[model samples]
Target: MLTRTFLHFPQVGERRERALWRFGFCDWHAIVRSVAPSPWRHLWDEWQREAEASLEAYEVGNAAYFAMRLPKSAWWRAIPDFVHRAVFLDVETDGTHRITVLGIADSEGYRAFVRGQDNFDEARERLESAKMLVTYGGSHFDLPVLRANFPDWQLPPLHLDLCPLLRRLGLRGGLKAVERQVGLSRSPQTDGLNGWDAVHLWWRYVDGGDERALQTLLCYNREDVMPLPTLLALAYERLWAQTLKASQQTFLPMMGSKERRTG
Candidate 1:
C-alpha cells in the first residue's frame, strides 16, 4: 500500500494520485519507469531519489520518515509494512482528564500501566519502541492525555487513528459501536462497560482499595486494545478494494525487486 501511494509527491493531491493510478503508474516502480514526455518529467530523478531514501528508511524501521511525509489519514498504508513493530494503545482517564491506566498491546500481549501501581516510564519506553501506534480515538483523546502526562516522552512514529478513518468508511460512532457493526464482540465481563465505567472503577480501586475494580478496569482496557488489529486488517482490505475500484485496476502487478525490498 505504501508503494502504491503517490500523495507524498510534491503537488500531488487525491485527484492527481487517482489519475496517476488510472494512467497505470500504480506504484513507486511504475512512476520511476515512466518515460512519456510530460511536465513532471523534470522531477522524475528527484522522485526516484526520494523513493530510494524512503525505501532505506523502511528497511531500517524508521517509520517517522514515512509518517512525516504521508498524511495521517494515509498512515494505514504503512501499517502492514511496519506491523512487526506496531502496537495498539488505549488510555483510561479520570473526570479531570488525568490518565489512570495506560494500556498497550503488541503481537505478544497486553500490558497495563496504572498511574499509582505501575511505573509510567515503562509505558513511555514501550511507546517509544513501537514503529506504529494503532488507536481508535487516540488522536483527539488518548494521545492528548498521554502528551500531557508524559510531556517529554516521544510517541510512536506512525499513529493510525481509526476514529476518522472508520468514519471516512461510513462507519461512524465510538469504538464499541464500530466493533459491533464489524462483527467484533467483547467478553461478558468487559462488554457494555464504557469510559465512565473505567473512571469509576479506577476511583473505586484508588479510594476504597477494591482490587476487583482495578482488575475489571484492566480487563476493559485489554478488550479495547485487543480488537484493534482485526479492525485495522479489515480496514486495509476494504480501503484497498475501494482504491482498486476507483483506479479501475483489475489486479495488482508484481513490484520490482527494489520496491519489494522495502516491505
Candidate 2:
C-alpha cells in the first residue's frame, strides 16, 4: 500500500491520485516510467523524483517520511508495510487524568510502565524507535495525558487512531463496543471493564495496597493493547477494498494479501 500510494507527492490529493489510477498509473513505478498525457504531465518529472525518494524511504522502512506526507486519516496505508515496527499503546489515568500506567506492546511482548514503580527509559526507547502507534482514543485522551505526564518524550510519528478510523467504517462508540461490533471478543476477566474501572482499580492497588487489584489492572491494560493488531488488519482489508472500488481500479494484489481477488 505504501508503494501504491501517491499521497506523498506534493499537491497530489486524493482526487489527483484517483485520476492517476484511472490513467493506469497504478503505482509509483508506473508513474516514474510513464509519458502519458494528462493534466499533471508537467509535474511528472518532479513527482518522479519524489516517488523515487518515497520508494527508497519505504524500502528502508522509514515510516516518518510517509507519516509527514500522508494525511492522518490515511495513515492506514502505512500500517501493512510498517506493522513490524508498530506498537499498540494505551494509557491509564487517575481521577484527575494524571497518567498512572502506560502500556505498550510490539511483536515481542507487552510491557507496562507504572508512574512511580517503573522507569520510563524503556517505554521512551520503544516509542521513539517505533514507526507507527495504534491506539483507540490516543489522539484526544491517552496522548494528551501522556504529554502532560512526560512533557519531553518523543512519540511515534505515525499514529492510527482507531476511534475515528472505526467511525469511518460505521463502527461507532468506544473500543470495546467497536471490538464486539467487529466480532472481536475480550477475555472473561477484562470483558466488561472500562476506563472508570481502570481508574478505580489503580486506586484500589495504590491506596489499599491490594496486590490482586494491581494484577487485574495489568491484565486489563494488556487486554486493551492485545486486540489492536487484529483491528488494524481488519480495517486495512476493508479500507483497501473501499479505496480500490472508489478509484474504480482493477484488483492488483497490492499488499500480496491472498484475500484480494481480481475483479
Give the best candidate by lDDT: 2
Alpha-carbon deviation at 125 in model 1, angstroms:
1.9
Candidate 2 on 109-171: residue-level lDDT in tens?
A: 899998889998999999988888899988999888888888898888899998888788888
TM-score of candidate 1 against the unseen true structure = 0.90
For 51-141, candidate 1 gives per-residue lDDT tens digits of 6676667667677888899888788777567776788999999876799988898866789888877887877777888888889998889
lDDT by candidate, in order shown: 0.80, 0.83
TM-scores, one per candidate:
0.90, 0.92
Report, for all candidates in order, the number of backbone clashes: 0, 0
Candidate 2 stretches greater than 4 Å from native? 251-263
